[model samples]
Target chain A: MNREYKTGEIQAGKPVQQVPWLEWLAAGIGLFLVLGIFGVIGWQALNGATVPPVITVTVENVTPVEGGYRVLFRAQNTAGEAAAQVEVEGKVSTDSGEEVSQVVIDYVPGHSDRRGGLFFTRDPSSGTLAVRAIGFADP
Target chain B: MTSERYAIGLARAFGGAIIFGLPLLMTMEMWSLGFSMGRGRLLLLVGFTLAVLVGLSYFSGFEKTFSLKEDAMDAFAAFGVGVITSTLLLVALAVITFDMSWGDIIGRIALQSVPASVGAMLGRKQLGAEQDMQAEEERKQEAGYAGELFLMLAGALFLAFNMAPTEEMILIAFQMTPWHALALGVLSMLLLHVFVYSIGFSGQESRPEGGTFLSTFLRFTLAGYGIALLVSLYVLWSFGRTDGVAVAEIANMLVVLGFPASLGAATARLVV
Candidate 1:
């Protein structure tokens, strides 16, 4: 067996076993992607996303589902931690003072918008739908 | 690299990625973390994973020999293999697609890559046959108690990080009764001690100073499990999995996370 190469060990006119081209290619691409992930996440995190004390819920669309009408809503979390089992309540003004419906969202990651639905007996479109984040427990 | 040699390594890496990263690839919370994890935290995790990869390369990596530059390069290469394999699998499963934002695409692939990279680094060690019992003997001679402990810690971290971000960890804890939790705790400690004691992996330190069953258990096995729990708790916190829960709940979460972590610790010698 040939002896192992020492540090900077090479002979004149003998082509060093070409460091496998694939290794270099792999190394380069890996570093680039890792740094890219950091750059993308860091930039957005610093500039755009912030986890507020409370999630802000906005009703996006009111659609009819099987049992009742569903309120399609988005909750925006700007904070640093994910909130699970977030309770969102929707209140609509009808001829009766108000009709309230509540739904629990499974998970809302910080700094992202997650869509959920609130099933309501009354039509949300007919009346004004006011959605609010009632409470969230940390996962 | 020889064509045949490269083929073997690539195949091993592919298999390793699937074996290690498949569950995480399918997990929704993992997908969530991939996209929504704060940049600062994700960057730190990536950096930490890189450092650990380099260290693992020093002990047991895909490379045949230990060279700093080579190990560093191989670390990146291993990570590349991890990323590529993860991307392909997730895409095949439709977990990743063209319509998703760049953040989501990058997040899921990169997060899963962490475990995949470790598996890639460990491919030859775990998947391939042992070629050098001499090297194994040398490692056993040189890797004293502290070194063995480090390997266990690395193993714990690798396994704990895989599942800590998911909501299921806490959910499982909540589902378990106190008796079940205690039974699991006893099982964890027992398994940890048994694996390290009965199994003779390459770096199994025969005995630390003051060698005795009691001493070994107290010093290494018990301590190793402690590190596993601590690592579990830390990973949970870092992922914000433990953000607003009660202290008791946190303890449960740690134990739940610690189970796999302890298994990792017990098997560290085989992998690292």
Candidate 2:
């Protein structure tokens, strides 16, 4: 098959081959990504730990919404496992009474943060606002 | 090769990557799986993807290369296109932001690159000009029994990979009773056989020369279904869906994933 192809090539008088600069560039990019990703994953494998999710929630800010005040918070997972359906509860010690609000975050990956908002009828800033991650399900 | 021709091929690769990768890219579970999945499994997946790409290039690559070296190069080029396309789409979707750690960004892009690269490799057949496709069809006929099985495996893996990362595979498995699992398994095999052998789909493979119905059915459909089940199991394991599941539940999940996998295997010749 190679010989037949070569003879046919001769008969057709094939043009001089153009340099495959684009192909080389693409291959180079691919090579770089393959190596880079391998390196990152390898590094993680060597140094990473497998621990249960340790979630911490902190209040970011409070803003007024339609019917209530929105308390934006960030939930951070510091361990090596991901958590799903993370329930974060916010408690505010208001002068009238204590206002409690809760929000559920869908997922928080290990060593990552997810943002969510909790609604309260009263301004949380008027009192000490405390936000804590109540619990999480294994993802 | 002319630069214009190669350029056009590259363009088609990008198109294919986007078309194929978009579903996984938009999937929320895939994004989280990037960071949450085990590093070892991720590495294994990447390695398998490269091997599949090389095999695919041998059968029908973006370029018609006769040598293994050229095929490898084409595979890498497809991978490169896949990575670039995945990165751009991920960024545009805001799935990966600058604030995320390098590990997260790299993990997300690398995971997504698998489907994108496969799409890029398949793009030539799906999007190439009519004359080029005729040549590709002829080359496909040259692929023998082992090659046919390999294509089935590739197709199975493609569909399985897409579905494995989602939670619904496990959820659906949990919902199914044993009877449902058995019925689904039988239906998968039956449809796989019909699509590949009986139906007159484009690129359908005729029964083997001098082979009877039972022989063809035993050799191709049964083998392809087996490959699909295996591929489905492997993909589910890679996604960590089988880590703590019971053996019975795992079997159910296997049958559930095997449905799309069988379809993919059945349509490998028509699509890939």
Candidate 3:
């Protein structure tokens, strides 16, 4: 610490009591950041014991489109990898068998959701509707 | 040699990391890549990034250096600062956690370390320029072509660093038609050339008049675009965007990313 030379010997000999605002600020930020990081890690560890949820496809809404009925479905992924080209299938039980409708979803990132719609020329309100995740690939 | 100067440099470096490297730290794809990217690929990317940092240090570093050795040393030093900065921030954000494999933590930090390191380097130049009063005489002389090229790299790195980590690069490529991609490429080149011409850097005076048009467009514009493409490719690859993608799709993504990189390249001289 350099002291002013012009000052008297007593003053000059005194330790320079200068405040390093920037260094202190930096240290403060760094300490705050380190503490914040530990806090977050602790929070996450408490919250993340649960495994990534498997994607569950559920029919969200059924509405009438121009030509046919459009069934909106939501695909939720629990895993870390993206589910690409997700194919969601809708099967309506008929007296005869099962009438199926499938829609291709572009992608759904892990721990996220994507919406897609399936079109059916024939009204399926007359039967039981079931939707399932048929397949997916990495994007 | 004052501690104040060191503190200021460090403060500026932190600012640089936030300014230049923060977006990627928050990017979802980047976080995903930290886990998905193979170790070999990650290592290669780190090696290449270090090389570019050393090269940039020679041209426009946090502090000017007279020798390749100094530049190399500065590169590693900046890298150390960058890694520590990035790791701390990422952990603060909970981007790295104990649940993730050790590989995941290292990969994420190393990948983010590139732009953070560059930002650290730029912090010195951007914040400490006033201290360089003695170098004014040496700086006045036009930087050679290699210097210009490095400047372009810096600019491209600055701009591309923000966009490369996003999912938008692939999303945009997927959305574009062939015509759209072509138009983007043309526009990128045109803008790159026009931006440089508008700036009229002193470095331009070196071009002789006879074949000036051809030389300028070919030598600078096209070359800048090339560097941008390389940068885009590197960024995309480092982020794991290119893995398992079709060749055409990769090319499209490259062009999409190259647009900003070329703009960065074109405007390098003004920023530096």
Candidate 4:
């Protein structure tokens, strides 16, 4: 073990000693400890994390008025945060998949928080209404 | 690549993903899950991603005693195995949490994964065969140091964006604890390594003596079963938590945790 590099052994230099089992074991433990700490922290964070407010759309009662029915929708930020721009669309269809009518509304989210309405001439019993919302920051 | 190098590579890829991608996904998941965005959200997301990546890096290094020159094909095969295994584990999570009925979960996955699977298969073919073999040889020659780094970085980024549940996307779903994530990550890597070795040992060149195939199959199956059990436990534990947790969130995390290993394996297999 004490022999210096001889002639033949001089080709590649010196032999590398294998890591001891104790060193490996210690390293393993240290690694786990670090991981466990992060794990706990992340767990807590996920459990108590918050999210952004969403633009909400609600449809009011649908009653027959003349040929089409009247539908009312309200949009608001229930969280009271200022959303920039809001756009809502509605599609009315008959039970046979016939498109009765559609409408779109656009407004500033916080500044123009208001309710709007639309009228569609279609059979009430066989009609379905679908609404979608898209929001953005207004320039 | 050596096992040590592979592990290091996974660490870097995964770590990079968390740092860069986790926040965006988390934000999306949280918002989707109906949580209000606040100051702590960013910090929490960043912290969690870093933590998971660090854990993965450590685990990869821990497995360095094993050989790393195992071909990439073995890793891809292991990933295929993992997808099946993760599916079952996910089913168990759904059952335990009651977030989704088994029927519903299975049905949705069946519908959704078809496109994804088709895409992966086609993409795999286009990536080349002999090129992969040459690359594998080159990686081996380089001691897999660079390959590991590339993989770890790529994996981490992919997960941060595509895998971690976004705030807005967190719906009625399950959540995973870091313990579960760490365990599952390590367990998946181990199973993949075993599969790699089993494949090598089964080869005519690698094992000229050619022992019984049943013994190899049995050993691999048993190890796979053991890994499945551990993964199931992690999934079960994750689904048990529901405080603003969406079923998609846990599901997404599982993908993030498992994706890198699978990707690294698949990439190697495809290239080799």
Question: What is the C-alpha DockQ of each candidate?
Answer: 0.32, 0.50, 0.04, 0.04
lDDT of 1: 0.75
lDDT of each: 0.75, 0.86, 0.69, 0.36
lDDT of 3 by residue, B122-198 (tens): 77766665655334224424355766787788789778877887777789999999999999999999999878875
Predicted model with the maximum DockQ: 2
How many clashing pairs does model 2 include? 0
| Candidate 2 per-residue C-alpha lDDT over B1-272 given as tens digits, one digit per residue, 9 for 90 to 100 | 66678889889999999999999999998898888788889999999999999989877788766556667788888999999999999999999888776667888998999999999999887898743566566566666788899999999999888888887998999999999999999999999999998889988998889999899999999999999999999899888889988999999999999999999999988877
TM for every model, in the order presented, reads 0.76, 0.90, 0.64, 0.28
Off by over 4 Å in 2: A1-19, A62-70, A94-96, A122-127, B131-138
> Any residue pairs clashing in model 2, and if so which?
none
iRMSD for each candidate structure, in the order shown: 3.5, 2.6, 10.4, 17.0
Worst 10 residues of 4 chain B by lDDT: B30-39
Q: List the residue pairs that clash in candidate 3.
A: none
Interface RMSD of 2: 2.6
Error of 1 at A5 (Å): 10
Q: Model 4: per-residue lDDT, tens digit, B115-187?
A: 1222222232233222233323333434333343333333333332333333222321235555655665566
Candidate 4 lDDT over A48-130, as tens digits, reads: 32223256677876778876678777765443223434566667676666553444443322212346676766654576677
TM-score winner, 1 or 2: 2
Give residue A136's lDDT in candidate 3 (0 to 100). 77
What share of the reference contacts survives in each candidate?
0.42, 0.61, 0.01, 0.00
Q: What is the TM-score of chain B alone in each candidate?
A: 0.88, 0.97, 0.87, 0.28
Which 10 residues in a row give candidate 4 chain A its minimum summed lDDT?
A1-10
